[model samples]
Target: MEERSNYVLRDNNDIGTVQIADDVVAMIASLAVRDIEGVEACAGNMAGELMDKVGIKNARKGAKIDIFENRVKVDVFVNIAYGYNIPVTCGKVQDKVKTTIENMTGLTVTDVNVRVVAVSMPNNK
Candidate 1:
């Protein structure tokens, strides 16, 4: 019997393999976005919300990844802070996400689409 995993290490002489999961990639994106200055929180989509209701916490809540055709496409949903610049913040996120994923996982990130789902203002109370 042969073993199976998600990752395929692209080295012929190396005697090792790495299996990376989609959720792991999503988590990486989530962490990368958190390092930015203007992000308030990760905003999960409809399916993510439904999963939360069922007592399941998806680590890739805000980050969605599709790996195919020798590349990966990631979509991140987030709520931004009111005082920060949206375009600048998103650009930083895009760059960070792409770089971090590629550097950490050795995968090619083709597209990183950031969606600002909400704007949250600081409470005055």
Candidate 2:
């Protein structure tokens, strides 16, 4: 696990505190994307891939999370397996990711932008 800075935010009241980090959000997003069918992979970029190789799961891989005044926005790159409807798969990923993040983190998801980076064909192993 890479060292992540604490992302704590004071609640509306002075009663308690809330803490969350960028990596946590990314992990949630990656797992959410994997849960949906027809998604081959998250298509992690060079840095994310390198992190994974070292066993330090970046979680954010193909995901970029931006926090703005407590509202979160995510952009995810995806690789869809051949034979699936591009639009349908993208929609599912978007819905799943948005709902998952909102429900799990209790943060307002401004958007979950799905970028279809590449298409991959199934392997005959």
Candidate 3:
């Protein structure tokens, strides 16, 4: 991967620096979270799946990435299985996201915020 120059916004002044892109971090986090057990799905918006199918290759709409001086913050919207423990599952999601993003991008993960938007019951048709 090519290194992109980073920019800092300081009191309306632009400072050039080098950092990992937010999209790359988000995608790594999202995929890592999805790999954990008890996670029914990784996305909360329709556009997310559409983008995935269309080869957009990054988390959009429902995923937010905050870049900081020494760390990164990620927020993921998810749907959980009906019988899963909400707290446990969410915690696992947070852990996996943080570990993956940090390991892959070499950036410290300060926080991982998970929003459970819905629960999906098992289909018994």
Candidate 4:
């Protein structure tokens, strides 16, 4: 009698091999925005903080990422420095997020939507 093996065969298909998770994209966007000069901080809700506690500091709650065909869309919420120009600062954040994600991840960032949730003003007497 011949002995039988219980091993299963594997498929070598490329269709399901390449992928990037939404959390990774969100983290990348968060880091990119943080690197900008005028950015005070990245805005996050309660859930975001919880994610950070689990070692996912860059995880964002309200941010959205849509991967379609060869393009990606990202939305980020941030708080800016009080004295900086809001429009200019937001533009910088948007450009950084788009360029960084596209260059690093090879994903075409079609849109970078930035929402200014708050402004941080310096304490003055």
* Candidates ranked, most accurate by lDDT first: 2, 1, 4, 3
Q: Tell how far residue 80 is off in model 2, in angstroms.
A: 0.2
Residues 33-99 of candidate 3: C-alpha lDDT, one tens digit per residue: 7666778787646746665676543445446677777478788877788989999999999888888
lDDT string, candidate 1, 33-99, tens digits: 8868999877766545754576544423788777885488898877899989999999999999999
lDDT of 4 by residue, 77-100 (tens): 787878899999999988899999
Ranking by TM-score: 1, 2, 4, 3
* Candidate 1 minimal-lDDT segment of 10 residues: 1-10
Two-way TM-score contest, 1 vs 4, winner: 1
The per-model lDDT (C-alpha) reads: 0.78, 0.79, 0.71, 0.71
Clash totals for all candidate models: 1, 0, 1, 0
- Evaluate residue 78 in candidate 4 and report its C-alpha lDDT on the 0 to 100 scale: 83
Candidate 1 similarity to native, TM-score: 0.78
lDDT of 2: 0.79
